[model samples]
Target: MTTRTLGRLRRTDFPYYAAHPDVVYLDSGATSQRPETVISAEADFVRADYAAVHRGSSVATGEATWAFEAARERVGAFVGAGERELVWTAGATDAINMIALGISDASQGLGSAELALSAGDEIVVTEAEHHANLIPWQRLAARTGAVLRHVAVDADGLWSLDEMRGAVSSRTRLIAFPHVSNVTGQIAPVTDVVGVAAEVGALTVLDACQSVPHMPVDVSALGVDFAAFSAHKMLGPTGIGALYGRAELLDVLPPARTGGSMITTVTMDEAEFLPAPNRFEAGTQPVSQAIGFGAAADYLASLGMSDVRSHEEGIAQALVETVTRTPGVRLIGPAPGAERAAIASVIVDGVHAHDVGQFLDDRGVTIRTGHHCAQPLHRALGVPATVRASASVYTDIDDVSRFGEALGEVRDYFGVTT
Candidate 1:
């Protein structure tokens, strides 16, 4: 929680910062740097015990399966989900797609009636959602004859709880939104939205990709029907993520993917699928990646999420202060001193975001540029692109200072005058 503890966290746990001592990494919103424990966990598993899980009754298979399932338990518990409620997918994008595709199947009378979307049913999303959350529901609405509506954002790229409530109506079937905006770093009022969804008998799906890593998130506590997040963003390996659904809902929702491991019995004519998590996990699983994901969860748990949140809060404040003090730099999302995630996306008045990124890169400061996969959000904000500097548990005051110093020079370096 102190500066000393933050220093120890970065130096002792993360090797990426040590290796690139001069480079300031401020892109943890896109993907986090892994701890040594996570890297070792994956390598150690592959080196000592590598086998196809649940494919056979061999000792190797059993051991591999145990490790894989145990990883699932860790991740589920980390998110306040029962083990049965978590389904592994390729990543958060894939997880959202799975839910959309499964709902599409349900609309076609393939799964439980409760999840079925009939003609004229409405699906609501926010204007600030990342494409992963937006596009999937767009496809689902198109496929199911459901109407898609969105809660609009203001000039600052934020939507209010009242705006969200206004978007929902009697015909609303589902409400899908992000826990935090990937572009603007605005934290959505999740509990308020969940309450609104419940009032209308609408299902809630949360894109927790940005929130789960930076703060404490309990899917059950939030009362969302389903939530998705990726491991890579949370200091774990790529190619793995989790979809959390209520037990009863997951039990009935059809698996979007069908293959070998997820089956209970296969016939020439039909197949009976396993329940919940297993039914959703088809084909060969990401066994080693799951182990690494579990290790990442353990590492964060050891630090305590409360402390992690506290550390990032300070970083967020520093980032806001830095951006606000710099002339010709427009800070997106919440204003100075407002609560937000540890991400700062800004637009330099005269320079393109890519040019700003290049300027920073030249100064050994790393940041994300362009629309950051939320083109609609950028479009709404009336900008083509913006540069984003995000922080993680490993990011310190010096990192933010380096970013600030580099950013303050961006206009001068480009010969752009206010």
Candidate 2:
């Protein structure tokens, strides 16, 4: 199999593909296999520089803190954010919750007036959002008495900017949505949506989990107030992710989780917190994982997202054409020739998605099957689950061809004539 369009990924760089010669892994949507550089970065840091960050003043602590902040800078640069804009969290779930919970704190009059969410205000989201983005806002609205509204998706699990305009209003306080859909791979109109939020004086929160790793995403360019993504999705460690906020906004917003490292002064009753990132990062930080994720971001920057995007575009096109050309295989999301990410979720006519996934797995073509944490979108599409095959920089034409040919044989293998 040929490397489709990029140069930074030699199969040797990724230990998983190098070790397993026969497997065609197509599940990059769930998590990408870590490269040797990212893996080695983590191991090297743990071996050489493992120490508690932002606590002690010892030499070892200094080095560890330096590495941690260096990672923050590297990752910030990768996402077009300033050093002060990032706050590391457990993952995207935690990152989004950080913003939601902090806003909830505002609703309680515990934070600055910028974040205050009163009873009459509203929050806007899209129907194509993952549960990670959807549920938190639902909780946010419930907690603050704010109205929660969603831009509906069409039959293919896609929504348009015009539809989004209809959903937003002058009373909107926050607009939470995804940059790219995890299930359908539809890229959102970030600039336009941000403009929409701006006109209404609403804040924008982006679920960048599906966008950050696969493409070159600039938080500044997108004009989003806050964006969240995970390290695991970007070929780094699993337990770490980041929340990027506008420096000014984060400065005034209260920390969601409070404790030692995040606070400046603690009295017997009240504790005054730090600013921005320091305020948000509560306890001991994810030091080694942050280093690894920085290395991962460095790796992607080295490859250049342009090459990666080119590689995936070809794969996306092939996947769309392949699935749609086969009978009883309904391609979900934007049709071929549309601006989509490297993801294809399909509903096979006669077989369940789980069975389709297992059938492909037996043939050594690994794919993800389920609601993909997007049950609302699936419900909109009139399906319970879908077989989702997503591509990454390492995915090649041979892997693409294999999945298509195998998918064509699924109906016959299951012995269904309908």
Candidate 3:
């Protein structure tokens, strides 16, 4: 299927693709290309309304605060969260770390006991998790004496609901996993995982970096305790992401970061902090980046998430077909007919992934190579690395076709014919 048939966005909408019309960008899983509106939103804010938010009583401060809070509301509503439920951070990695460190504080008696971990308690994760989601939990487990347990993946690098169910038990305190795998393009059984976690009274933390930018995600509807996603993965600016927590949980999650702006009153001996978001946001906020994120959300909403999903469905099919049809290529994710995100990771029979990447780069086909920050998953897959191609709203059929053609020529270019 073609992107034209599925109704995709024009490349002209994005400044990067507009400037490099000959380049076929397929790296959206890492970071997306921003639309002109999102860029203008940030630039315009910097030029006209830039000021320190949540401080001082000047008119400039008031306008800045209003814009900042308005952006929060826009982003929250986009993901089915209330205004207070979303907390801004540096990125998804920072958001996950905040949650982990906050829970660590809880275990140390800094906050409410609802999320506190203790010796012998289990923190469940999957083998397919991104390092951002996995390593934080590992550190938390070490700090609290909790055991870090994981659901192992199959030969295809995909974890099943049964595996997830088997991993959680009466001692499970939290379950951390991705909504979609960055390496395998596998869509996780989130609802099933959430159900299993609920059965064991475990909190669910979703790494939504891959899912939110590609499909419709409702953290509340999904029944997760927390979710982490980056604005850059969804066509917004970098250095700004969101942590979606249940309002009650955020209010008591024990701020991992504390400074000016987060507290209402501070004494030499102790301090009293504000509620939810303010408790999490310390120091000066990312005001202009937040506005750009809100603009990206609005742009996607206007384009219709359903339409975006439909378009990516076509892209996924094309990607799978391309990999399956090419000789000497092994796809790392779901089978050709199975449902997946618009991502394809593959290993050429003889050429290294980096070599494949270089060959494609020479053809103006940009892609991600190496472990892709999934060393454990690559070890499990029995390969050192794989080249990954991902799509976004701006990607089209021609871009994918170019990728397929370049990929087909790789083995021959390296003189690897058997």
Candidate 4:
């Protein structure tokens, strides 16, 4: 939103911001702050109605089970998916690992032979991916004897459409990439990547952790076979994430983690698993957290994602212009006026990123400083670390301007004027 709306929201919805007037949080890319509605939804659910789901025949069990399933439907509709497409996981990392490990199991003759990977099959990824997205595929390759091919990023840490196209071929089994670069904030063309994968008869997977929270994302419309994202990043509670897969694909893919409530029938040696959402959810579900997540989705939906994108566009322009105008601060990612997410990652001329972060912290501003779990992207940019200031629905112009002023003073604070 614009400053007016952001300021209004700051006072009405966000308790943390209202309580701590001095602290300006600029780390929404890492994890967004929750609104009062989301906080109360979880607490209210736990306090008023807390019971095990899918295991009992009592009234409490039916009520709790209804709430839990209803939460999934709300979150699913938020992302433009059917009620059955969403599968609950711990977080984005767990969701990605679930797919990778499920593929591993398939290749090892565990469940669906249709999903198996051979020695010559290749899995594609971009160098801009975070470690969570990268490591899972590496392990999958190691376990299945498949080859991993990376679509390398350029000097600005970007993978072009041509580069992505060149990386896919007849041998490609899967093409997985992020919808947005967490470091560069460069938004990728989902349809382009999905088209390339479809041409090569490869399954498409999207690491939608960064894009889903900030902009509108429809997994089914994007034509991707599967997508993963985290609840915490979307202003929802932690310990719960979502994996959206085509019901056809999810039905056959082996469950990475197997336990009670996931199977339809279990006898002596052989057991049959349930369908999509239920098959993936094994143990007692994260009932309260999912309810909170649904409330978060409803909150965003009420504001409208189109308005959210328009608001972030303003923040992106401000962040880029602020960093570039300040001396000793080099802005990363696309040039000004380019299509990018509302995240500003910068490298100071002399001071280290951690020191820059501390410098901001001293001035009552909080930012994220490090490789951002994206060592490959950092290495591509030839930097050890960067200080990233990201924006969200509640971020105002004052927050961005404060970050710019603090960043400009970092070199001077460390006596690095030269």
**lDDT values, one for every candidate:** 0.92, 0.90, 0.92, 0.90
Stretches off by above 4 angstroms in model 4 are none
Candidate 3 per-residue C-alpha lDDT over 1-418 given as tens digits, one digit per residue, 9 for 90 to 100: 3476543445668889668979989999999999999999999999999999999999999999999999999989999997699999999999999999999999999988998999999999989988999999999999999999998988989998998888889999999999999999999888888899989899999999999988999889999999999999999999999999999899889999999999999999999999989999999999999999999999888877878888899889999999899999999989989999999999999999999999999999999998888888988999999999999988888888999999999999999996
lDDT of 3 at 102: 97
Across 1-418, the per-residue lDDT of candidate 2 in tens digits comes to: 2245342245568889868877889999999988899999999999988999987799999999999999999999999998699889999999999999999998899988889999979999999999999999999899989999999999989999999999999899999999989999999989999999999999999999988988889999889999999999998999999999999999988888988798889999999888788898888788999999999999999888877777788888888888889998999889889989989999999899999999999999999999999999999999999999997877887888899999999999999799
Show model 1 residue runs off by greater than 4 Å: none
Q: CA lDDT of 376 in candidate 1?
A: 81
Q: Worst 10-residue stretch by lDDT in candidate 4?
A: 3-12
Per-residue CA lDDT of model 4 for 152-212, tens digit only, reads: 9988788899998898889999999999888889999999999899898999889999988
lDDT digits (tens) for residues 1-418 of candidate 1:
6643684456568888679878888998999999999999999999999999989899999999999999999999999997699999999999999999999998899998899998899999999989999999999988989999999999999989999999999999999999999988899899999999989899999999999988999999999999999999999999999999999999989999998889999999999999889999999999999999999999888888888889989888999999999999999999888899999999999999999999899889999999999888889999999999998888888888889998999899889886
- State candidate 1's TM-score: 0.99
Candidate 3 Cα lDDT to native = 0.92
TM-score of 4: 0.98
